[model samples]
Target: MNSRFTGRLHLPGEDGYEQARIGRVFNARRPGRRPAAVLEAVCEQDVVEGVRLAAERGWQVAVRSGGHSWAAWSVRDEALLIDLAGLHELSYDPETEIVTATPSVKGGDELNPYLGRFGRFFNGGHCPSVGIGGFLLQGGQGWNARGWGWAAENITAIDVVTADGELVRADADTNSDLFWAARGAGPGFFGIVTRFHLRTRPLPKHLAHTVHAYPLDLFDEVMTWLHGIHHTVSDLVEIVAVTQTPPGEREAVLLVTGVSMTDTPEQAAQALAPLHANPYADRALFRIEAQPTTLAEQLHNQRTANPEGHRYLVDNAWLTGTAQDVVPAMRKAFTDHPTPQTFTIWFSMAPLRELPDMAFSMQSEIYSATYVVYGDESKDAEYRAWLDEAMADLQPVTAGQYLGDSDFTNRQLRFMGDEQWARLRAIRAERDPKGLFAGYLTADEPPTNTNHWER
Candidate 1:
């Protein structure tokens, strides 16, 4: 095993073993689950050999790309952890307008910067540091997802190492079952995806934004208005409403923001005009209307909102219902936060686009997620309880949950449609009958793929 791997391997109690295990994890709150051994694979062959080696030793395989899973799903007990941090392959084809990137590639920080050179862009995760592997697998809700659709929709192909230790390419035609599952299987995928072939769009020439900040006291009134009219806004604009304490501010404020992707200032202004006509603009603490912005500036703001090295507990729901029902149910999540850095977002996917036939068949017109960020280790339970209460408030209107922000060990919600979930299980049964892959880190024997309350 040592001879085949160009990268280093860390065994239990070995020097640097602990660092190799969780060094790349984004959340400060580490899990107690530990792998039997950690293999830091450097190349494609290393991944292949590592899987073969795991099979020979009868160890289940767990893969990590970018290590940014909020739940730290990569670290599993008695598994061979194949860390894909060293796989940094990236290239772009001018003719096809497709960018091929390794799974570990950071979507915002690395892939976008590289694509920007070619005047192209692939909508990736909002957090600059999130790796495309987990993000894309869980149905990436990237920037302008409301417009461009889920990031997985842009995936043209993926090179995967199957549970049987064969490296194969999965796309719309060949190995299509794997292709269908890869887009939305999340941590339950049966193979290690080495590379992603993604379709890219011509980078927008101008970026303009509109931001309206309202006092938290008006959360209901302001949110009700937004829910009623967001779908009427142009598709080129990404809209979101969030409540968080801004830098240098002691109290949290509700910020309704719209970012328009257009070629020229005139186009941007026109696309963002509807948002500027906000009824409560006069009551706003501040307003930035149709102001020019850059992707660099937008990414910087995302970094600020989701800072590193803090213990993060996140939960989300695909929401459905009228403003009258949804707005009131969201009051606790939007207004009462446990910490200053904690935030809850109301993302608009109104007039939701139809999803392609894939395993990720669950969504609603509204997406709500609460990120509880804090530093005190002793307060994990306290903060968790608070987050549970906040999310409970939304259950009256909650449809399901997105896997990206979910921790199934704490709570499990339906992440896929009933039919898609059944199809995914059949594929998993066929591809990995022996269960070589460490699937879905949950507290139960098998994840029910149903909202707990409904059960």
Candidate 2:
């Protein structure tokens, strides 16, 4: 088994076993579960071999692309952890305008930067360090998702190692079931995706933004207005409202922001004008409208907001209701903060776009997520309690949850439409009938894709 691996392998109780286990995990709140062995795959063949080895050893296979999952889904007890950090392959074709990349490729940090050289872009994760694998699999809510659509919609094909240890390509024309399931399966995906072939778009020539900061005391009034008008804003603008203390600030404040993806200042100004028309704009603490910006600058801000080496407790919901009901229900999440770095975001996907037939089928006009950032291990219980209460406040208006920021070990919500969920389970049963893959990490034996309260 050792000779079959081209890359390093670490077994339990070894010198580097612990580091190989969770060294790459972004969340400081690590899991106690441990894999039987960690295989750092240096190439695609290694992934194939790893899966075969797992089957021979009677071990389930768990995979880690960038190790950014908040729940650390890769480190399953007694499973073979295939770490793809070393399989960093990226290339582009001019004729096709498509980029082929490995699962471990960082979306914002590597993929976009490489695409930018060719005057192109692929909507990746907001956090620069997030890997494209889990992000795309979970229905990537990338930049301007309200307009450009979910990033997973751009997947042209995938090279996967199936549970039977066979390497195959999946696309609309071939292995279609696997392709359909890959787009939205997230950690429960039945196969190991080695490479993603993604379609690219021309990079917008001009980028601009609008921002309005207000006191948190006016959360209800400001949020109510936003909820009513966000759907009317042009899809070219990515709208977000958040409450957080700035790097040097002493307290949290509400900030309504919009970034326009357009080719000219005029178009940017026109697209962002609706957000700037806030009735409370006159009372804002500060305002910046149609100011020029860059994608690098935007990604930098995201990196700052979600910094590394910190304990994080994150949760999100797809919200639907009248402004009167939704705004008041979200007050606790948007206004309260247990730590200085704690923040909550109200992301807009208003004027919802219809999704193509795929496994990733659950969303609404409004998306809200809370990130409780702190470094105190001792206060984990305290912060978790606060987050539970905050999310509970949204129960009435919460339609479902996004898999990207969700932790089923803590809470479960409907993440996929009923039909899609049923189809996904059937595919998993047929594809991985022997249970070669370690599926969703949850407290329950099999995840009941129903909201906890409803169940």
Please, what is the whole-model Cα lDDT of each candidate in the order they appear?
0.94, 0.95
lDDT of 1 at 3: 83
Task: Give the per-residue lDDT digits (tens) of candidate 2, residues 144-195.
Answer: 9999999999999999999989999999999999999999999999999999
Q: Per-residue lDDT for 1-455 in model 1, tens only?
A: 57889998899899988998899999999998889899999999999999999999999999999999999999999999999999889999999999999999998899999999999999999989999999999999999999899999999999999999999999999999999999999999999999999999999999999999999998988999899899999999999999999999999999999999999999988988888887888999999989999999999999999898899999999999999999999999999999999999999997799999988889999999999999999999999999999989999999999999999999889999999999999999999999999999988757999999999
List candidate 2 stretches off by more than 4 Å: none
**How high is the lDDT of residue 122 in model 2?**
93
In candidate 1, position 196 carries an lDDT of 98
TM-score of each: 0.99, 0.99
Candidate with the greatest lDDT versus the true structure: 2
At residue 227, candidate 2 shows an lDDT of 91
* Candidate 2: 10-residue stretch with minimal lDDT: 440-449
Which residue runs of candidate 1 sit more than 4 Å off their true CA positions? Answer: none
